[model samples]
Target: MQTPFKLSLSAQDIACERGGRTLFRNLDFAVEPGQALLVSGPNGAGKTSLLRQLAGLLPLAGGRLVTDGADADTPIAELSHYVGHLNAAKTAFTVRENLAFWADFLAEGQGDPADHLAGALAAFGLGELGRLPAGLLSAGQKRKLALSRLFAAPRPLWLLDEPSVSLDVASVKKLDGAMRDHLKAGGIAVVSTHVPLETKFTHTLDLGLERAA
Candidate 1:
């Protein structure tokens, strides 16, 4: 909480293992505010594993992770939003209801205009379908719904995994803008993408070459 280093990520000899196989080890890196870390690698390179570790989902094999700056003093309960492949789409509720549920669950305040699902719906090309049941949406549409949840979140850290998957070209561009705005808003994003990014990376961390086992 002392702002030891702005936007800090310090992992000393960090390692991870899955299914008895060591995924990666002795990995150490740090990124600061106004910087984005692009995580890329071939499939099965432990990209997701590293992101999960940063999000505090998976335990680090040998080291620790510390995020400061805007996230200083923020509890893991409040520091970040971890979004992956899970479909939070409600088979029974409309898209609006799904986001509403998220806002309440994340303890976000009500009557917040920025939490508008409509704007996100339009940005993602799902405007007309906000009233429709999420279960009725196509796979791609479902992914868009997942993205809309971010707007209603107050966390400063974003852990996104392969967010570009299943998105069309235009949707990917819109997604890019959303991510950029998040960074511009002083948020930190750690994303793992197999697909290309729309903008230059502040830094690229390759997990494939860093595997320790």
Candidate 2:
């Protein structure tokens, strides 16, 4: 029985190496209440790895990470919701059930569970499809289902990776609006995308130019 060494909650000077290839290094960023950060980079630029560090899913080779809002950093797992490219839900569960699962998981006296569910369903135009199993939904509908988690769970920060993929124009608008509302509510978000976001935020970090050695 051994208690392994665990990394910090958040990281500065984050770097990663895969397959003996250096991705990038000396990265510094933080998430704050009411602030949103967009991580823009070319494919294979370590955007996901950077997020992994923040999410505490990967061990940092070197750096200091924190969650106390000290030096403007916080534990990503505690401060934000990380939405990766994969969606793992009981596809057989109805759309409402899917949301309800998350709503229930993250609902610990923050907001009323029912209110969050209603807001998510109505806000995303899924009121009629609430009972439909997620597997039966269209691609765009599934994407919407995926996006609904943001509203159901209240976190101070958000780590979204390529949220615009497979989304139609209307759904995209809805997604953008939801994100805008999230930012307006004093929540911080870090998003990675190749598509030009319609968001009006002036603060963004472009990792696309980071040269790999």
Candidate 3:
């Protein structure tokens, strides 16, 4: 897959606050095109919060988040794809229908999502399950379905929070391979995981340490 888009992510002394408590502060990191940044921390260390901030779903309590190589007017949310803990599939929808919805929404104007639908299902071994209702899929299958969107549409930045939650070892490997392919294509990934992944990560940010400081 040829990735014609180019973008880099950087955070400068960022901070996050929830309710009345500070989750993390003075956090900083940079990930260039084709690089992956691994975020690991103890529970409640704000790993998800940090990822949310990068995804533009949560506001930073302090500091700057920058994306280089994209149009200055482009919103970071538009240039990035965010997958959190929830498997956002609509249970009432069929496997392909669920994926197609996301592909169309995320890849809006990029291309006919149908062009990539079959390939996305095959990437995660969901080809045979495409016609089944998502509610009938196993937990792991649901996760795979959620992840299929990463391939259904190509985005410059990927913000994944605990993406391997329900994945079996083989599925994890598939995810790693997909991530590597994305990196090789000049895309960036910020992954927050407690389970060590097989993918190559160029940088790591430990919010646990920041909270301890």
Q: Compare the candidates by lDDT and give the number of the best one.
A: 3
In order, the Cα lDDT scores of the candidates are: 0.72, 0.72, 0.88
lDDT of 1 at 118: 46
Q: How well is each residue in 43-79 modelled by candidate 1, as lDDT tens digits?
A: 8888888877877788777776766554466654366
lDDT of 2: 0.72
Q: How many residue pairs clash in each candidate?
A: 0, 4, 0
Error of 2 at 170 (Å): 1.2
Candidate 2 residue spans exceeding 4 A from truth: 1-11, 68-75
**Residue-by-residue lDDT tens digits, candidate 2, 1-213:** 111112223347867777777777776766555566778778888888777766778777677666654235434565567777876556889999999888888766666888888877876799899988999888778877877887776776677888888888888788788777777776667788878778765467666565542
**Better candidate by TM-score, 2 or 3:** 3
Order the numbered candidates by TM-score, best leading. 3, 1, 2
Q: When superposed on Cα atoms, how far off is each prediction in RMSD?
A: 4.0, 6.7, 1.1
TM-score of each: 0.86, 0.85, 0.97
Q: What is the lDDT of residue 145 in candidate 3?
A: 92
Give the alpha carbon lDDT tens digit for every residue of 79-160 in model 3.
Answer: 8888998888999999999888877788877777887776688889998998999999999999899888887877889889
